[model samples]
Target: MSEAISYIWLGVLAVFEAPALFSLAGIGIPAPLVMLLCGLLTGIAVGATPGLAGPMAMAVSLPILISVFGVSADALLPVFAFLIGIMKGATVGGAVPAILFNTPGTPDAFMTTLDGHPMTLRGTPERALKIAHFSSVSGDTVSDIVLFVCAPFLAVMVESVLDLPEKTALIILSLSFIAAVMGASVAKGLISVSLGMVSAYVATGQGFHPRLTMGVEALSDGFPLIAAVLGVLILGEVFKSIFDMWRGIRRKRAEDHNADLAPDGLRPGDIRRILPHIGRSSLIGCMVGALPGVGSTLAATLGHSLGKRRHETRKGPTDKSFGEGIPEGIAATEAANSAVSGANLIPVLSLGIPGNAAAVFLILAADSIGGFNPGPSVFNFAAPEINPELVVAFGIFTLMALGNLLNWTIGGIFMRSMGVMARVPNRILLPVVLLVTLTAIYVQETSLAALWVAIGFGVLGFFFRVLEISVLPFVIAFILAGSLENTARQAFSASGGDPFFLFRSPVACGMLAAAVILVVLLARKK
Candidate 1:
């Protein structure tokens, strides 16, 4: 109880102190720099092991999270919040490399290449990256502020009157939103979600887990989140590319002889050009990020589409047209993608529901060590044990600010240096990545089985990428399936299996209505 109270106080302090910290930095040291250092240390340590990714870090830290902070629910809030904030900032900071060197430092920054590459071609790569970084940071910061302000109110309403049935309905509603907003086709997205649910059920129930096992018995506990992510996002991609090369589907390009091809820094005019679309893109990103399944790529696409639509609808000849190499497209995409970083945390932090694969891993990590559960009850139940809010706020603020600082100070240098990494033979890098993944998984559970599971997922992930199916849905659904099932079962048991009992509460009814509406709208779109 004392620990929980201390956590809550810490959360309050972090919340109030974030803005002050921002102000103090007023062009002194960049926030992104600090975030980069922290994240770099964290990532290197986590990434060095094959099976330990961001989620695993969180999981491994759970013992410390619970013991050091105490097991109260609220105590975990601040830590989770801080993680979210850091993720938000880091997601944006990653684009610096993606824009400058065509090497996406993070998975979420992939889409930045579309416009970012073009700017690099125009000899303004630094300017483009800077703009992207600024827009992303701006969007994320704004969205976090929004989440901080709104989540409590939403939680209040959810906690005060929501019964079991109402809660179940809300979960369904959230799921529907996820399916509808994600992927090009709602059917495909829903199918992906269904696949994830089935996989989770099979893994948990049948005991033949989807991504666990390395053909060894020791890893039977199941695959660690870290291993799965590294395989899917990093190692898998590298292997796939190598395979393609082997098949002659891809060939090495001749080294660029022209030194002039290198990117020049951004111009002052570039910043001014992107300013107009900042607000719109940020809003789009925040909304999309708050929903599950819809990730940074979609957020970027949506922001671009909205910007184009707005630009087209304007009557007179405007100085800024969106499509023809205009900075607004870059701005909108950057802001939207960045905004997702923070907003994605809303569900993960407030409820145990993970909106994306990364959050799903985080949830797994939290669950592994008997820490806080994800849900509305987390705030109330854990409040006395751990202050999740404070941890979340502090971590986020630190990471976001640090990430941005890193972007401003060394982002360009990093991008320039990344060319060396890209030049490194894939043969060496792939094996290294694989080795790291294997080692990480082995340490997590002392099991070789987990390593095999990661390999299996890597192959599956490669196939999914080739097939053009949305992997996000499957990942999100898999994470949420257990909670959804448990909650529904509880609600049903409480209501004596009477379906109508779920509709008795106004909140439940409203959520159901919304779900229906969402389905109808999606059907119409189809």
Candidate 2:
């Protein structure tokens, strides 16, 4: 405890001191870059081990993180707050490649290709990248503030006397929200979610002890979250691309259109144009992020769609030209996606459940190393041992803030110069990514079986992509499956199997009421 407190104090001093160092005139270095490098170095060190992942890094570093400078939960709060900023910044930083070279650094940046790529075709790739970075940063910062203010008040209400049944009901409500908010059709969303639930059950050893292992000893340990995510989202995308290539969907052009690039910098007017949509996109992003299964892709798509819809409805006849390489599309998508980074952390920090795939990996890593669980108890019990939870949180926030500032300050310049990155042959990139993933997984358990499972899931992920199903639901379901089951068991035991115990608590009853209201509203809309 003493050690944790000391680290907290140290972190606080750094927080105040960092800005002063960053503000030194003509230093030409941005604060966020420093934070990103710190996070990256930390991530590489912790993530470098075979079995280690992000959460594990946090857990393992907990003792040192706490002891180094008298860190404690309260003291670390600013650090975590700073991470919110870092995540937001990083999300935007990804857009640089997406616009300049049609390569999306992050999955969520895929939508930026629609108009951003076109802007590149029209010789404004740098401008498009700049707009994306600035708009994304603006949206993320604004959304973080909103979440910081609202999460506590929301937690207060949620913490009030809730029993097991009500909590289950609330989970149901969250699922329903996902169904309503996801994809083009309710039917498709339902199907995607159902598949995810099934996958979660299979991976978690349900029904029988050591379930679905097929006599493989390694399978008894269950699936690795990171491997699963890589398989489903990243590897899956890769497979889909391969399939597309097999079917002759590959682009044949080789020449760089803007070979002699003269990129434009973002003007003050550009920032002003995107400011109005930032709040709306950020709110949407946060709400989606807080809900499990809904990721940044959906958030960006929904934000853009809504913005387009609103514009079309307002313009009527003039709306025909609405979505053609417009800045609004960039603003809406970036804001929505960036906002998700912070909102997603809410459930991870407060509930111990991961809202998306990356978070799920982080959670598993944390459990393996920190000896901490990712739920409400973490804040109370683990805060002593890892008292620097707040510091870590603040660290994340600082990382995000610095990340964004760096992206805004140098993203355009770097993107313009780094256009060659996009031209790299996919043949090389794909294999390298696969090799890294395999090496990472092998280091964790040294099990060949795990590698096979990852490959299998990679194939499965590809199929899902082809079917146009959302992979986020599967990730969310996987993270929550155990919690839902455990909570149900406890509720049943407490109620002596009466089932009424769920409704007995005021908090539970209120949750039930809210669920009912949401269901009614969804039904009415349908």
Candidate 3:
């Protein structure tokens, strides 16, 4: 117990006493805290804007931030702090446009629009914004507490039990599960996964003879990871949005909520009215976020549905019901989606699996920085001496707590300042975004070919969006491909070149069998 307490103390000290970003009047300011605020503010600003999101901001800033703050071991906390702050701030900021402009800043914020915009139309935008901010911070705090308690134990448990083959099978199961759940049909999701895996595996193999290089020497190193990830995600969306705008068929607006303005609206006491909804939805979001590949959209949907059901069951229906400018609706949706930001790290920190796009950026930051290896090893407590990773992990917890503090105090100010961002049209916004993204990729990799590969992946992403396929599976598969391949190879060699090495252990066999069963069941369900 003393050892544990000491380690936690050391972690906190590391964050405060580490290298500073800059000095003011001979006093060095901690880099992590500064970057956290900067990222959070940036996230809020972007999240309030239509056609921008936390993931996009994180993706764009990553390369640039790496350049500014060299990839030293000390830089890890600050970079991670910034990314996490973005995740938190964006989750809350997305509610701003949904309420004020009747625009969902992100898909999960679509649910917020149901009640949020209605409240705005009725001349109580402040109340709606307050409800969103309060509920979001509340949910985020709960989730952070849960993550702090759960991630270490979970990572340690996974480290103790899983070997190479078992881990390999687990990855297959995870990919299959993600594919099954993410899209309209299992087949389409599997196709997306296949495409991602193929892209990942191309030009990757032993030494001089890389597989699927197609006779191009540039292909020998494969596409740049940053370009491939951001291109498919950000640039692809840019293209899709531009095309949609050109066709004069932009995203359809929600149905009109101008009718039936209820005089009796969100009073200060209404916080009590929405408390139950917030509590339940926050739990829902945390659970879903912990599961790899499950995202904030589903959390918001489920929370809204449950809130509606509860309200109907309890008070019947009224002008101020779930979708009609009710505080409960805003509370439920905001809490649910905001909760996902903290809990999504469960998979990333514990299992080295990214649950969503924001989580993907977190993994990317770790990989690019090179000091941190996020997985079960991150929480290995048996190290006899001081474990730097453990200390850093604890520092991450401290930064998260500080972010929550910011959310409670000034986050509402940022959350409500969404109106200005809406003025920037997609025409100006998209091209600028694309230019910045490509420029950052080029600068970081110092390879012009990387830009072309990124553009190619962006086109592929555009197709994925047009076809209505969920991109989650594809991104997750791409990220996991290298780990999966390496683990499988190690397991194969350890098993004396056994073709069926994955089924050698009972746990591995069970997981592989589970993957098959899961796909079969999900297909039938689909």
Candidate 4:
């Protein structure tokens, strides 16, 4: 216990003295602190704007950060600190659009739109925003604390029990779960997963020459993952919004929509009233987020649904129901989604598997910057020389704490201000977002080929959206396929290419069976 407490104190000291330890790019300033501040401000601003999100911000900043920091062991902490700030900031920021304009900047905020916009229509936008801020920060803070406490233990356990075949089977199970539950139709989800697997296979020289590049020299490097993600998710949304605006669909009204409400700060009584809802929704988010392949959208949906059920069961059918300008609705959705931001890191930290889009970006950043990798190795301890990845993880937690503080102090103000900004013409907002997105992609890749790839994926994504196909499965599959292939190949190679190796291990067999059962259950549910 003393040793653990000592390590905790050491981590705290390291966070405060980070500037002294990391000297980045010959800059005298404390890079982590400055980057954290920049990330928070940028995340909030971009998240408030429709069609922009935290992953987009991370994608844009990643290459710029790598270019500036020069990809060394020292650069890891500063770079990851910025990402943590953005991850926390964007969750709080997304509520601004959802509450004021019924526009969810990210998929996780979709549930917020149901009740949030109604509150805005009721002229209580401030109150709705406050509920969102309080619940979001509270859930995010608690989830981060859970992550800090649980990740190392889980990683240790996995390392002790899981071998190569079991790990490979686990990955397969995760892929199955994602395909089963992510999309509207199982057939569509399978098709999307196939597309991702095919895309990932392109230019991948896994005991075979690169295929699918069409003999183009630019394709030799394989598709840029960050560019592809930004194009499909961010630029695609920008393109859709532009087309919608041009067609006079989903356009903002020209008249100002700000409401003149009294000071809408939450009182102690109000906090006490909503604390139970926040706790319940946060627990839901944490559990879902901890499961690999399940995501924030589902968490938010489930949280809102459960909260609504609870409200109806408790009320005498006379109280104002959920989604009827009630604070509980905002609390449920915001808390769940915000909690997901932190708990999503659990899988990434323990298993080296990214659970969501934002986590994929984090893994990419860690890969791009050398000297760090996620997984059980990150939690390994060596005497005298601290585990660098573990130290960086602690630093990330510190930055997250700072971001939560920022949200608690000023997030409500940002949310309140969104009433005015939400009225900005999509014509102007979307085009700028598009230009900035493309420009960022260009700067990062430094090639016209990358631009073309982004444009291609953007068009594909637009059509997918139009067809009501979910992109989550596709994105998750794309990110997971490379690791999946590598792990499977490694497992096979270790077993002398024995095809039945997976069935030999009880753990692997059980996991595969569970996956099969889960798929059947989900398909039946659908």
Q: Tens digits of per-residue lDDT for model 4 on 1-526?
A: 5444555665555566666435569745567777777787777776787777788788778878888776887688778877877777778888888888787767777789878887777677777888888899999888888888898789878888999999999888877777787767766777777887787778985656678889877777788886777778877777877777778786342233455365554545767767888999999999988876677888899899999998888877577788666788889988998888888899888988778878888888888887878887777654466666667766676777777777788765765565555567677877777777788888877888888899988887888778766666777778878888888889999999899989999999999998899888888888
* Candidate 1 overall lDDT versus native: 0.59
Q: Pick the candidate with the highest TM-score.
A: 3
Best model number under lDDT: 3
- Residue 132 of model 1, lDDT score: 73
What are the Cα lDDT values of the candidates? Answer: 0.59, 0.58, 0.87, 0.79
Off by over 4 Å in 3: 23-27, 254-266, 316-319
Q: Over 4 Å off in model 1, which ranges?
A: 1-9, 12-36, 40-90, 101-111, 203-243, 248-266, 309-326, 381-431, 497-500
Distance (Å) between predicted and true CA of 141, model 4? 1.2
Which candidate would rank higher by lDDT, 1 or 4?
4
Question: Which candidate, 3 or 4, has the higher lDDT?
Answer: 3
TM-score of each: 0.73, 0.73, 0.96, 0.90
Question: In candidate 3, which residue pairs get closer than 3 Å at backbone N, Cα or C atoms, i.e. clash?
Answer: none
Question: Which portions of model 2 miss their true places by more than 4 Å?
Answer: 1-35, 38-90, 102-111, 184-218, 250-263, 305-321, 326-328, 378-391, 408-416, 503-526
